[model samples]
Target: MKPKCGIVYNGHLQSDKFMVQLHWLSDTAKRHGFEPELIGNHRLIPAVIDGRCTLLGPYADYRPDFFFFWDKDIRLARHLEKMGFRLFNSASSIEICDDKSRTYEVLAEHGVTMPKTVTGPLLYEGFELEDVSSVPSIVAELGLPLVLKEAYGSFGEQVYLIASEEELIGRLKSLGAKPYVLQELVASSYGRDVRINVVGGEAAAAMLRRSETDFRANVTAGGRMFPYEPTDEEKAFAVRCAELVGADFAGVDLLFGPDGEPVLCEINSNAHFKNIFDCTGVDLAEAMFRYIRSVLYAADGSRKGDAPC
Candidate 1:
C-alpha cells in the first residue's frame, strides 16, 4: 500500500494566492505515488481530553504517515508533532522561520553571515510602549535608512524602511508593543535580492527579484523576476541557512553585499513556491516529494519499495 501523505493547509487563508500551492502539492503527491489528503488546519484538532492528549475533530480519525504543514499556525503544528506525527520542516523550524527575530538569533548563533540586527523587546501586556529611551541608541547604531521588521510577518508586508528618526518613531508608535527588529540597510541591495529555493540540502532553483519603486523586492510588492545563476558562495550560504533552521524545503532570500557576497535576509519554512515556479520553471512540490520519500526511506529503510516513486 502507498504511504498516506497529509497536506495540511490553513483554512482561514483561502484566497487563490494560498490555495494555488495546496493544489500543486496535492497533485504532485499523487504523481509521486502517495495517497494525498488535503487536511484543513481547523479540521485536525489536537486537544487535551480524559487526562491525556487527544486529537479530536472531523478529521481526527484520519492519520497520515507524515504531514506537510503548510501554515504558520505554530500551536497546531507543535500539537501534531506531540501526537507522534513527523512533520516536514518540523514544528520548531516553522516557529523559528515564522518569526524573523528568532530566525536571526538562530542563524547568528551559528556564525552565519547576515545583516547587523537588533531585536526589539516584547511587550505582551498592553498596547502602549511605556518607554522610548532605547530609540536613540538604536538609531545611532543602524543610522538613517534602516530596516524595521515586525518579528512575525510575511511577504514583506510588515517590513519598512526608516529614513529618518521621525519616520522611525511613527512606525514604532503604530506597532505598539509588537516585537520587531532593526537592522542596518544593505544599500547595495536596496531594491534587489535573490530568492533561492533549497530542497533536500541542495539549491533547486533561483531567481533575482528587483524593484525600482520599493525597497523590498517581493513579487507581491510589484517586484520583477529574472532567472538568476547563484554563485558557489550563494548556493552554499542558502543551503546552510535552510539546514540551520531544520527545514526540509525552504526559500532563502539573499542580499548582495558590497563585494558581491551574500547576506541573509530571512528563511521561509513553508515558503510560497508558485512565484519561484513562475520565475524559474521548477516545480518545488516535486522536489519536496522526492526529498520526503527519501527521508522516509532513510528513516526505516523498509519503505524503499512501498508504492515506489
Candidate 2:
C-alpha cells in the first residue's frame, strides 16, 4: 500500500493563491505513489484531553503516515507532532523561520553572512514605548535607509525602509509593541535578490527577483522574476541555509554584496514555487515530493525507486 500523507493548510485563508499550492503538491504526491489527503486547519480542532494532545475533526479517525505542513500554524503543527506525525519541515523549524528575529539568531550562530541586525524588544498590548533613547543608537549603528522587518511576516508586507531619523522614529511609534528587527540596508542589493529553492540539501531551482520601483524584491511587491544560473558558491550557500534551518525543503533568498558575494536574507519553509516555475520552468513540487519519498521510505525497506521526472 502507498504511504498516506496529509497536507495541512489554513482553511481560513481560502484564497486561490494557497489552494493552487495544495493542488500542485497533491498532484505531485499522487504521481510519486503516495496517497495525498487535504486537511484544513479550520475544519479540525486540536484538543488536549487527559494530558494528551490530539486532533479531532472529520479526518480525526484517520491518521496518515506523515504530514506535509504548509501552514504557519505552529500550535497546530506542534499538536500534530505530539501525536507522532512527522512534519516535513518540522514544527521547530517552522517556528524559527516564521519569526525573523529567531531565524537570524539561529543563522548567526551558524556563522552565516548576514547584515548586522538588532532585535526589537517586545512590549505588552497596552504598554507605551517611552524609551526613545534607543532610537538614535539604532540609527547610528545601522545608518540611514535601514530596513525594519517584523519578526513574523511574509510577502514583504511588514518590511519598511526608513530614510531619515524622523521617519524611523515615526515608524517605530506607529509599530507599537510589535516585535521587529532593525538591520543595515544592503545598498548593493537594493531592488534585486536571488531566490534559490533547496530540497534535501541540494539546490533545485533559482530565479532572480527585481523590483525597479520598490526596495523589496518580492514578487508580490511588484518585482519581476528572471531565470538565473546560480554559481557553485551560491548553490552551496542556499543548501547550507536549508540544512541549518532543518528544513526538508526551503526557499532561501540571498542578497548580493558589493563584491558579488551571497548574503543570507531569509528562509521560507513553505515557500510558494509558482513564481520560480513561471520564470525557470521548473516545478519544485516534483523535487519536493521526490525528496519526501526518498527520506520516508529509505529505512523502511519499501523504496519505490526514482519518481518519474
lDDT of 2 by residue, 108-150 (tens): 8786899989999888888887777888888888998999998
lDDT (10s digit) by residue, model 1, range 103-203: 99888778688888999887775767667788888889888889999998888888998998878888888898789999999999999999999999999
Off by over 4 Å in 1: 298-301, 304-309
- Candidate 1 lDDT for residue 292: 89
TM-score of 2: 0.95
Best by lDDT: 2
lDDT of 2: 0.89
- The global Cα lDDT (0 to 1) of model 1 is 0.88
